[model samples]
Target chain A: MDCWIAMCVPGGASLAALAEVEHRVLGLGEALGGAPWVVTHQVRAAEGGHYAGSLQTQRGEQAVVQFAELADASGGGWGLVDGTGLVRGGGEETHMAHALASAIAHRDRTEGRVVRFPGQADLPEQLSLEELVERTVVEDVVRVGVAEDASPLLRTNGYVRLELADGRVRLPVIPWDDGEVCPFEQRDQHPCCDGH
Target chain B: MSGRHDHPHGHHHHDHGHDDHGGADYSDLTIPDTELRPADVSRRRFLQAAGVVGAGLAIGGFAGPRPATAAPGGGRGRLEGLVWLNGDHHIHTQYSSDGLYTVRTQVEEARRHGVNWLVITDHGSNAHARIGVDKVNPDIVAARSELRDMLVFQGLEWNIPAAEHGTVFVAPNSNELTVLKEFEQQFDGTVNGWGAGTPANEQHAVDAIRWLGQQMLSGRTPSALFLANHPARRGIDSPHEIRQWQEADPRVAIGMEGAPGHQAASIPTPNGPGSGRGFYTGSPSAASFPGYPLESYRTFGGFDWMTAKVGGLWDSLLAEGRPWFITANSDAHSVWADDRIRPPGQDNSAYFNANGRYGDPVSTGTPRYDRGDFWPGYYSRTWVGAADRSYMGVMDALRAGRVWVGHGDLIDGLVVTVRGSGGSNPPGTLGEKVTVGRGEDVHLQVRITPRRTPNAHGDVPRLARVDLISGPVTGPTGDRDAMSAPATGVTKSFEVRGGGEMVINHVFRAVDRSFYLRLRGTDGNVSAPGSIEPRQDPVGNSDPWQDLWFYANPVFVDVV
Candidate 1:
């Protein structure tokens, strides 16, 4: 095998040895006699910007690819291509460096709908589903007023955290505003509560 | 235009720094408690060339008396100084394809600007109810007898556009609209469904807002109060907005606007260049930043559910006691432009220039004061809470945050303390950023009264101050490409990568809205500046359309 340019050691990271030397250089010119000429495989990524993905090859040589924005490096961590020359490092190509780091962690195309909501305050950046869209909706006046401290018994930053439809954190107000009134959050706190 | 006009604002108190001290007319022009917000640039150019007497507004009340003293640190005692609740909700009189501004000059400028209330909501698509724009000013609610002063209500603002948010009200009637012809005849598309109907979604405007919230809970309509209008916006079908309700049909949406045109900027505490999250000292998008949209040209200019807590939607709806309420609106939108002020996202006009930058060719002067011109209500106002000066006590104190807001400067004796307790639940919980990351969501203190007011562009407004923004929630991470719902994308990635820091205070929320920073004069623009967006970019602000004023009443975490 008279190598014109070949180094695909794909064994993982360094991009799995450049996908096992680009599958042993197209099976080494059909096993190493030479002459089909033309297998241009290039693998890169020296540090960060990850750019974000788009490089796959299993036999379908999509290689017209050229990237080199990482200038300066050579204790063997390789890298430094201003005019374009040394790409080196297949040192073997382990299955296309895990298929290009799992396609550089691909994932793109999402408009909405997973609804995982639970913490981060169920996140809509501020929790609001609009009662799913609406049915009996009503509001005449709820006015609670208190940037904290006109009452509620003072200090500790004070206290009043409510929403828990299922698991329970309930508290609609017990020693909340000041004794005698603590409906604990209604649904069943009953007639002001004597127990029922 | 002759300086020495010290500062009383809104309906004018005029101090011009003691009108130059012979002592009688009060210092004709000395105003220096550090210029207490600016006596026309400290009498320097003295009203530029003396000449803004345009005046003429006066309507239902306050074209005259009511100053028993007290504006500097204003009505203190329990701290009632910054005031704020003043309303407008939406207006557009001739039924909004472009409202002319009437209904007696929108209740005589909400009673010659004394404003304690003035909803007249308006805009449902306009049928023109005798055009009083719904009504509400009885001489600013009969000068609240002994000068408790100014008020007005009637209201409307339903503007539904097929619903994702947008609701506003004062209601007793009307949703106004027709021409549906078919599309199941309309409901969520609003014909007056105060309950906001449901179930229609292939998107014909959310199925006409679910057939107009089921024809307003089946009664067909009336007895209104509704809210959710700017509950963090999102429409044109559904960018997936918020203001919630639909657990089968909860109705009236309840309140949330947090602070609609809310000038934006606060939550800064910790040494602040605007607190945290947003690294890349070298470049991911940093042209510059000392603390503000001045982060060179980008980093955070507006979108404040008081600082992104809509990711928790008022901390899971106030933990559990669900009574939920909050307000502040200017939602204004009628423009011709030579300079009406408009700029952020720029729908009603001004402030959209897709990078090339606009007016001043895009950024002509120092550090940024970019006043090429757009306008839009000028800067700030909203404090409505009248019982005698009524619009149903300013929509029952805007459903009930009691309300408060001030920008450019003005507030007198507005108290709001957290955790010390008073008439209701004080025992545990009040979140936003996981309620201050579990320290118990409460820590706000404000006290105002500084003078130097004139924003809608009479110039004068360099510092203004007052912010209490907060944050913390990230856990969800399943990744799905995020557009909101990774718990609202962890509220703008927690301070935006710096990981945490949210405290925009000067007292805010539930009636304690305070102010008084007032810096006045000098177009050097650094405390909150911008200029760039010559405009255009269909779906490429990168993915930003949330900031209809941050998300109402932030404060939610883990919630159980």
Candidate 2:
């Protein structure tokens, strides 16, 4: 039931440690909070700009965990998915807080979203961190991932399919030549960005 | 028309590329009945040998991407394949007050999303006009090649009443939609409004479109591609409009807009046919239109965000083996927020620039028409399937049914290939199907995969379903005299229900721009949003301009 779990500061936040990282976290502690869940993540920073982070929850299971802004840490990357193959309990785990709101979003409502491992990827150069996150967000939207309520800015919170390379992530999409008309909003009717 | 300027003897191309996703298959179904005529196809091949598209692309390389998805099973997929591109043919500009755009900016944005070629076909019916292209097309080509790699071209859209009930397309950005508009100008005096208190006519609309088709195919080839602009969406008394149009002309009215604006308008009506003093109306539905005061009008429904439902029309035309293109126009009236087109506050001044001043010296400078707001952005687009990336090349590629309609996205990347038992192609249409009345077991196969586009916010739409609208005919000539009757169309559909990867929304993700995967349904009636994204445009029955979203002259194969 935990809406969010952050190891360190969020996106682009220059943080030193994952949990102690200063960043904004949403929907944490929304689920059963009786148990404690271990967290790990990465953070990023742009010289003077505030640091940012991304949630990479894995292995541990808890209701919610706050990964506040990390003014006290260096900037670069956010949470890391506990890939230790650690035995993390199961429940309805959502990708992001809003993912938990929309049933069509995450499969783990109370448990946790099973982090996906990179099978193989040909990561490109000149790829910036924001662009990497942007790509992941795009991949998720392309796959209809991320719950409706998921923040448009949180590429990972909405099931962004990130392809981790050297030390970055981005969506893997190639333009097509001929095919059916793009479904309306795929390019035109984006609900998240429409000016209303 | 005299003061107009266009690329005198040239055309430009933009930077359109294909989507890079895993492959999609259409081999499970039968192939098209007839393919493009060898000689004509070869004639196009000859043009390709000359590398028109390539040359144009080399020149207009700056025009963003305009790549077409390779049609699978087309043997060419066997030929090392090429990249997918996109294009948007039917767009309007500030010249049409009801619109919101300009030629330069229009072409610029096309480059931004990587649309190679763009045709600015503003509403010529309206008297409102613009000071169009100068020595700028080539400059645009050079600049786009330098910037977004997009192509820019000159095109004029005629908006005369479809007495013929048709919409026509022409070249030479300055070339007015004279065929029909001229007569109106002469007959009605005023050009854009309810000219001399005249009601919109179908005959005029049809003749204009049909004639364009005739001119283009018959060798006259007036740098033009006349298509029926939102035919079924507006033409009332369906049967009457159809019959009259067909009788008048039948050049190559490809398709009407499937989704012109970002979303088709949904009209609302009273609970039931409110028996009025003189008339009756349909049942009440959703309220979409804002200021029109629908609450007061009870006899009929409001036609706000109208998306054309011309399947009945396209189906019939397809029977003859003609592959008319399907298209969409933004037909927007406003852009409230970021004119650059972001989410949550899209207020395009093209419809009515917030700072528009009716008289005096108009702001003449960079971004011409962007601030004008008169039928601007999000209103025009058409796809072509050509051997090379040139006008003639794409034209030849298109007449053969290898195209799609993208209201906002360019029409390059996503390609549509229908395979039946006939030759895989034709000159005017795609693979030929026996022309007969409805009655025979025919198999159709369609496939589409995800492709990349301008992922600004990175929100891609999920293809809920691939709708196959089989009947409908279009062209400059109104609805080509084909009377629409209360006839039910027999259909065969295929669902992309194979792997969990192919499922939509849940799992099946279409990286490709469009959603029509050549699938069929018992009674394929998706919500007003249909396969289009956003699905927020009001759906209504009133304003014919906005409501009618999509239109395609299906490759109809009669089974008698």
Candidate 3:
């Protein structure tokens, strides 16, 4: 399936740099669509700088998904993306797309930028880059400490980031005020400790 | 809270030259049971001399079109000869971009489910502003003729500025469409003339209410009113904003939803839609009021956090000495457990933008576990004690605060009366302001009747307990952003036997200061003080019939 992506290039980004960022977003979408974790996933660009599409599984479970850029987090290049949408059965597509977006946004950065993704709680049993892309997207991952402002942003997403076994942080996707608590039993067998 | 700015207070002068809707029905304001405070004959003589008694007879003049047929009914709290009309002010039809049914379908469903009055509030959009608003009037007028007993109003779900949505409705007349169409064009946030959630747009929200008031003043319609819907869904409806809306047009800006619709959402399963109760799953955004807590973000028992909290934001407004009332509605877009699905092959946006072609309601044989809402009037009911069953009667009662709200047929009848010894009349019903001598005491009489028939769900609702909440009318706070009422709370709770009607009476000795008392009843399954405790936020419950509640407007006692 197709994914929609909107890019906000940094203030001084060149035309060539902007084109490269757009090309990378398309590549990331294509990688996610080709992944085996999802039964079917597609994204397409829509009006208003939003990507509107669908993601489904072999079990007939699916979601009407939309993805958009929050802001230009990439200082002079492409930035990581944040995703939110209603999921049926599991939010694997939403989780995978968001992780891929983060990995893509942070692919070439050298400042040790720590990217935060939503649904820190909904990560799959085996959290690995291979599940999302053809091969190693990043050879060496920077385990930077969580940013101080990450708490507030995570709070806005109705989650408090968790310090996983490998010092990675993730958010609980659903906000509390929505009145529906996450009903999964993923806490006991968190994906962070499940070896990549 | 400390750094907040205070808004300038509006002039409190309200002229009382108009005739009260029920000219001679004050005697019907009876107390089934009584408790009295001792005062000399001079006390009765003094109240008569001071014009404190029977003053409600001349309260803000109601000059509106009278009902062609006035049904007769006798109830303790109703205006002498008037009756109670249960209604829903917030409703949506196919005209609303997200709604699924037509005008006729909504009216028929609501009437069958026991609602006597309903307002057709399609969402305000540029398309609506251009053509849809004018187009829906003939259907509404036709519906009114078809169901002459039911009052069908024309309204729009206004995209209120700097905050949430509100219901802007008027007493239906030939000019109703003209007024709503123009009003939306001028003040709606989605309309091209104004932007969303800005200070200027906030002021325009106030301007819009006053403009509706102007419509009433110009005799375009007998009455016009605006009510904020699902206020706490986004924490943007700040205490100051609410205070400002009321101060901007006290007569026109009435109250908000005590219980929001979508009662059947958040079904506890893997594939459920999980929109949360009332679709209120939003967290604090850039536009949110920072003062709200994490607990304020969610719905408790299908109600906004403000109203569910015994001494919460709603009480904070009432503590300011204004009659800011509360209501419940369906916000009905698609009914819960619905069987239809969006016709296959169309993209979400395409189906949404293309209104009628979305799909027809062909049952798929299996219940749509993901759909999250109830049809209007099927579960939530806003009961207005009106002088008559006409449009003006309903609007005037709402403006007067003579209303009670219920969910899942929790209680079909509720009468709350506050009586002063010196008043020659029986007592003052919900929303009336009564006066008594400084040393004289006041008594409260509360009665509730269980629904005789089962609800649309076919389950009989059992009354659990009634909570009587009272607080001093401590005027407006010094800090405009104050969001709590430490002084207001559940002073007493009366337990009921499951089989029948129940009544409770209590007397306050020498109530020397101004204060107001209101009532709330629940099924007792979910009960807490002020706000729902953090751990008790029920997230995945799908059955609305299991957790039921009813709320009554306040009855004020003014001591001189």
CAPRI band for model 1: incorrect
**Candidate ordering by TM-score (highest first):** 3, 2, 1
In angstroms, give how far residue B556 of model 3 lies from its true place. 1.5
Give the alpha carbon lDDT tens digit for every residue of B490-542 in model 3: 88888888677788898888878977889888877654334322122444544
lDDT of 2 by residue, A124-178 (tens): 4234334444553322222121123323232121222232222233242211111
Worst 10 residues of 1 chain B by lDDT: B279-288
DockQ for candidate 2: 0.01
Candidate 2 segments exceeding 4 Å error: A1-196, B1-84, B125-149, B162-167, B171-221, B232-239, B242-249, B262-325, B332-336, B339-381, B406-443, B451-457, B467-553, B556-560
Pitting candidate 1 against candidate 2, the one with the higher DockQ is: 1
lDDT of 2 by residue, B48-77 (tens): 332333343331232322222112112232
RMSD of every prediction: 26.3, 24.6, 14.5
What is the TM-score (0 to 1) of candidate 3? 0.68
- Considering the two chains of model 2, state its CAPRI-style docking category: incorrect
Off by over 4 Å in 3: A1-196, B1-79, B193-195, B270-272, B341-366, B424-426, B528-536
TM-score per candidate, chains pooled: 0.24, 0.42, 0.68
Error of 1 at A81 (Å): 75
